[model samples]
Target: MLHVNARGMKCPWPALRAARAMREADAILIEADDPIAPSELEALAQQQGWDFAALDACRFSLRRAA
Candidate 1:
């Protein structure tokens, strides 16, 4: 699993980083403080046919659909 720290990061940064890593890995754990992080990431995961789950208020996990 890949780990990405997008905490305190702005929009697109987190999503872009995650998208970059997704090219190499099927699963990733993202940590972000951005309120929209979850929703944005969730949309990306869905678009990629991956699974998205909330780990906490500022943490989430994404994995290839299984």
Candidate 2:
């Protein structure tokens, strides 16, 4: 699993980082403290057909569609 630490970053930044990682990784764990990160990341996963899970309020895991 790839790990992306986007803490202290805002909305699109966190999601963008995750998306970039998805291109090369099968699974990614992103940590973003922004209040909107969860929803934004979830939307990205939904659109891309990846599995989305909230490991916690500030952490998310995304897996590539199989």
Candidate 3:
């Protein structure tokens, strides 16, 4: 598991960092206060067929599909 802090990051930055971490992780949990985090990550997960769950308004978790 990997945790990414994107509280102050802008769009693309959080997504980009998360993507980088995804390369090395089987699963990742991303925490971002940004409003765009969920949408952006949702699209990415959908495109990749990754499993994702929104923990709350500002936190989400992604798991690699088996």
Candidate 4:
């Protein structure tokens, strides 16, 4: 799995990076503390048809829908 550390990144950036990374990997783990990252990521996953899982308050994972 690709690990994306967006802990300090702001909104859109974390989601952007995760979207970009998705092209190269089937699964990705993201650590984003931005207040809006969760919503953005969830939207992205929905739009892309990926499985979204919130590992914790600041950690999330995305996997290809199967």
Highest TM-score model number: 4
Model with the higher lDDT, candidate 2 or 3: 2
Per-residue error at 45 for model 2, in Å?
0.2
Residue 57 lDDT in candidate 1: 95
Q: What lDDT is obtained when candidate 2 is compared to the true structure? A: 0.96
lDDT of 3 by residue, 1-66 (tens): 899888898887777877888899988889887788899988888888889889998788888889
Query: How should the candidates be ordered by TM-score, best one leading?
Result: 4, 2, 1, 3
lDDT of 1 by residue, 14-59 (tens): 8888899889998999898888788899999889888999999988
Off by over 4 Å in 2: none
Is candidate 1 or 4 superior in lDDT?
4
* Clashing pairs in model 1, backbone N/Cα/C closer than 3 A: none
For candidate 4, lDDT tens digit of each residue in 20-66? 99999999999999989999999999999999999999999999998
Q: Which residue pairs clash in candidate 2? A: none
lDDT of each: 0.88, 0.96, 0.85, 0.96
Compute the lDDT for candidate 3. 0.85
**Residue-by-residue lDDT tens digits, candidate 2, 1-66:** 999999999889999999999999999999999999999999999999999999999989999878
